[model samples]
Target: MSELLDNTEAATKAVVDWLTKKAKTKSKFYIKDFYKIFPDDKPRAIKKVVNKMVETGELEFWSSGSTTMYGLKGGGIQHSSEGES
Candidate 1:
């Protein structure tokens, strides 16, 4: 396997852009799944980028049946916490 070789800023953009595409279809994604797309970076590193994206509002996340999923802001996706019993 090649060494992880991606600039932090570029990696961040790649992740955000990928999620943006998914958002167009109102699709949800997980951090682990993202690592598969951006395999150039380590899983932990990808996680940091994802978390930062959420923190800065580039992406929005919510829990679903114990799984955390992320979607683009204004994508109209709701969380598991909403009126679930």
Candidate 2:
């Protein structure tokens, strides 16, 4: 059970890391971009992870008219405690 949780955490961190890197130059990205990076996961799964990240203040979302975009809460890159780059 602990292993399962660890794997989930790692996956979530990967998504966050990717978004953080992108946010450096791009002001925002669609949730679908995350789907591309993590093709193994379903959209619903990705949304769940993204929601959690937003809730934890690791990410932020914005809406431009009808389009929505997402980015890291902080402007700088955020590394996982495990030293993931």
Candidate 3:
């Protein structure tokens, strides 16, 4: 059981990593895009994992019409100093 859980975690991480990389180049990704990236897994399962990532602050979401777009947080911005702008 523990091994299964570990594999599941790894798979989820793989999906997250893939999405993060894609989002870096593109502003948004829809559910079908995820399915294309990971065709072996069901779309619903992928969405579930994505929701978990959103909850954990690893992903951010926006809605456009009937689609939900996802992207990385911070928008690739990095802060160097607190009051040294």
lDDT for model 2, on a 0 to 1 scale?
Answer: 0.69
TM-scores, all candidates, are: 0.69, 0.69, 0.64
Each model's Cα RMSD: 3.9, 9.0, 6.1
The worst-scoring run of ten residues by lDDT in candidate 1 lies at 1-10
Weakest lDDT window of 10 consecutive positions for candidate 3: 74-83
Off by over 4 Å in 2: 1-6, 76-85
Q: Alpha carbon lDDT of residue 78, candidate 2?
A: 31
- Backbone clashes in model 3, listed as residue pairs: none
Q: Mind giving the per-residue lDDT tens digits that candidate 1 earns over 18-84?
A: 7776666666777787977676667777777778878888778878578988766646536444677
lDDT of 3 by residue, 7-51 (tens): 757756676677667755775567677676556666677777677
Name the lDDT of candidate 1: 0.69
Work out how many backbone clashes candidate 2 has: 0
Off by over 4 Å in 3: 1-8, 76-85
lDDT (Cα, tens digit) per residue for candidate 2, span 1-85: 2232237678677876776676658756788887876676668877777778789887777766898777777443332222554
Cα lDDT, model 1, residue 76? 59
